[model samples]
Target: TTCWFAPGSGSSRGQGPPQQFNQVQTTYFTSIEILSDLYKKKVLIDDYLVDAYIDTGSKVNIISYEAAQNVTSSMEPSNVIMRGFGGLHAQSLGKVAFKLFIDDLHINSCAEITTKSNLGSIDLIIGQPTINHPDISLVTTSKSVTLLKNNISDNFLTEMQLSSTDFISKVTLFLSDDVELSPGAQCEVDVYTDHELDTSHVIVTQPKIFSLGNVSYFIPQAVLTKTPYRLQVVNLGVHSINWSANKLIIRAEVFACRYVLSVNI
Candidate 1:
């Protein structure tokens, strides 16, 4: 058989520049069943650790109205309309931007906020924007998903296969240098964490009973900026006090967002 094909023809046999295919963005709205249980993972939304549904099939992220309110009161107007599995449609109230921490991956993500009824029991939905992030490399199977960054994977396994404590663990701060506090004096001491944190600001709380005893010192609750968090220690005792280097001082919860320092003076 003899065949003739045009170079610019929009056909499989065409040799010219192939027809450019414009990609259309797709939005997926989850059904009650899928949103409740499928691909559920614990992700840090702003500072709250909540169960977030991971929907790789969708392109846009979503958060329940109640969840968005808890994360942030500020919401920008959004005109996105989402379609569910069974042709059900929902209108997004607005969009909120927040920091999301998925294991070792940190994403400054924005999500459309819809009514709670639209999400059923789910609070957040992590969609392709997160899974296909430029900084992340994801591998998935029928029952599991793994997230990798820079070719290194550290327990970024499926939710069922990994424990929440593995990633949401507290960070311990240690005194960075030897410090001596004089009577009725206060000093701002620098503390170091074992590893870098995802968020720049954190809330540091003194343990119920710190290693320091009979020191009459007070470490106020404060929001500390990272890369060597500074803590204020007030020595109320009548004598001098010394804290050696690398001494455990206070601990900060991972991704803690709220902290207050009150002073009467």
Candidate 2:
């Protein structure tokens, strides 16, 4: 449960939308209790509490201007220029010191930004940079973030491929049940070759699934890519299906250019 605001309104002038802007604008209703806190000078900003958005695509942390004014009366200005869906907008490039409580956990840091928009109902945009550390697990569906302190091992990468003639609506590839890897291990699955342009439009799931029968798969072509793609599997389903080992393992990394394959999924 997250809501999105386009960087610019319909009135701004520039290229339509920014690249990789995938969220819908409709308000997302959820029962999850949102947490808040304040950060400044590497310390908590007194009793200020703010709601945060767990955005996976956002590369930086952002705060509303109203929230900033409530926390402090005077502060240094920022020079960072942030561009959104519309185009370019000025964002103060100053460090943020805030406190946030997720469930019973409390965290204080000096890494945050203050913006001007109302941010709809969200006060903070907890982007990639903030969660880059291994401790943060920003689960969008659950509207919660889990912060762990211990380091975890990385998982082995897995790849997948589908036949061009197969009309399957969906496919899931699963890894071995005993092979425990890091939670964020990079998984690459090649659906088809460049020459087979028609088959390149396949969709791969994130956090590749490795469950029942020690395999998972996905179907229905979506996009084309020349190089091997690193996919992330986001969910797990019931345990009733098994996969065949003879299943094709499409080449991951492609070098020289080749002809396109014209088959439908």
User: What does candidate 1's lDDT look like per residue over 45-132, in tens digits?
Assistant: 8888777877766667888777787675477755455666254555556688988888677788999877776676678878778888
Tens digit per residue, CA lDDT, model 2, 7-119:
43222222211222223211111211234322111212336777666555555566666665555444343434345423334334344566555434455544334444425
What are the lDDT figures for the candidates, one per model?
0.66, 0.39
Ten-residue stretch with the least lDDT total in model 2: 24-33
Name the TM-score of candidate 1: 0.44
Q: List runs of model 2 lying over 4 Å from the truth.
A: 1-46, 72-74, 111-114, 139-145, 148-265
